[model samples]
Target: MSASSAKVRTITRIAMFAAVLAVCSQIAIPLPSGVPVTLQTFAVGLVGYALGAKRGPLAVLVWCAVGLVGAPVFSNFMGGPAVLFGKTGGFIYGFLPMALLCGLAAEKELPGRIFLSAAGLLLCHLCGVLQFSLLTGMDLLKSALLVSLPYLVKDLISMALAERFAAALRRIPAFAHTKC
Candidate 1:
């Protein structure tokens, strides 16, 4: 493919990934503290695997921007400037760098392998812990152990599954040109 065409493809992939993430945000598992756990991160990992570093973070940025415009794209259909400026805002805004850095770290093969997914998950945790500490005023170590560690195993599994799924998707005829 020509350079221009490749850039277009990358941009398209990022848009598609952002749309998928917005949809996934609706599938929320409510937490006791009013914050919910959602499958958005799973899509985040998938986008990173499918699009690699450059497009993956671009996708995340799109998602964030859409939500900021009162799109009701977040968990429980909550959105708008208030959604970002509220208490949960930090975590919401944090998704960009988390996905960006994680995708950058995992930017290796076409479909991210297990090791890359694990590393990406770890990066996500690090970003999350940082945000959690900054937002909640908790110590970094406490946030890491309490907030980051509990979700580590689950997020790892999700990342691995997302990577494997991307690998499978890339083999299909429809996605052949996109390279998934």
Candidate 2:
């Protein structure tokens, strides 16, 4: 393909993944600690694996920007600057780094992809726990136990699924030609 065409394709893919992130954010089940169990992380992993380090974080950033601008694209359809600065904001913001780290690792072999994705998720959880503790006036360790612990297994599952999905996608002609 021509250079311009390739760039357009990349941009289109980024936009599509951003939309997927927004959609996944809406599939949330609220928890008592005021955080939600959502598919956001799953989509984050998928975007990272599919789009790679450069494009993946762009998609995540776009989704975050949309939510920050009051598009109701966050968990439980919540959005706006208030949500961006709220207790759960750290997790949301952490998606950018997660995508970058995960995508970078995903460009390697399968084991590397899985390991890095888990690490990325851990980073996200750390951000969430820290912010949750700060905003809610709870002890940091307590917040980590309450908020981060409960979600570890599920997020791992999501990362595994994203890896599988990305592997499958890489076989397709369109994606096959694309590089991380």
Candidate 3:
């Protein structure tokens, strides 16, 4: 491919993954604590392995920027600056590091990948717990109990599935021969 085309391809992929994340975020089941069960984590995890460390985070950043600018790209189709800095904002911001860490997982063997991905999810949960606690005036333990703990198993499963899906994506012709 020409240099310009390659750049276009990269941009297109990033935008596409950002859209994927937006769609995933919208698949939310709202709860009493204001946290929602969504495929956002699954898609973020997929982005890391599918796009690699650098590009995955770029895609996530794009999604975040869109939402921050008032696009309805967050859970339950809600968005804007309010979502970015609101009750569950920590988890939203956490997606950055989450993608980065999961991207790093893509470089490892199966065990290491799972470990890193789990760690990344833990980090994301920690960010959520802290923010949820502070914003809601709940105790840290209570926030964790309510939001983080309940989701660990499901989120881990999502990460594993994301790895498989990413592997499948890598088998596609466009991804097979390209360094990007």
List per-prediction Cα lDDT, in the order shown. Answer: 0.72, 0.89, 0.88
State the lDDT of candidate 2 residue by residue for 10-125, as single tens digits. 99999999999999989999989888999998899999988999999999999998888899899998889999889999999788888988898878776545667777888999
Stretches > 4 Å off in candidate 1: 1-9, 101-116
Model 3 per-residue lDDT tens digits across residues 1-180: 799998898999899999999999989898887899999999999988888788989999999999999999999999899887788999988888899888888866666567777778888999988898988899999889998999889898999899899998888997767643
- Give one digit per residue, the lDDT tens place, for model 1 in 27-132: 9888654456778778888777777677787888888898988899888988798777664565565666556655654555445445555655666667666766
TM-score of every model?
0.78, 0.95, 0.95
Regions more than 4 Å wrong, model 2: 110-113
- The TM-score, computed over Cα atoms with residue i paired to residue i, of candidate 2 is 0.95
Q: Which residue pairs show collisions in model 1?
A: none
* Candidate 3 Cα deviation (angstroms), residue 158: 0.6
What does the lDDT read for residue 86 in candidate 3?
A: 88
* lDDT measured at residue 34 in model 1 versus the true structure, 0 to 100: 44
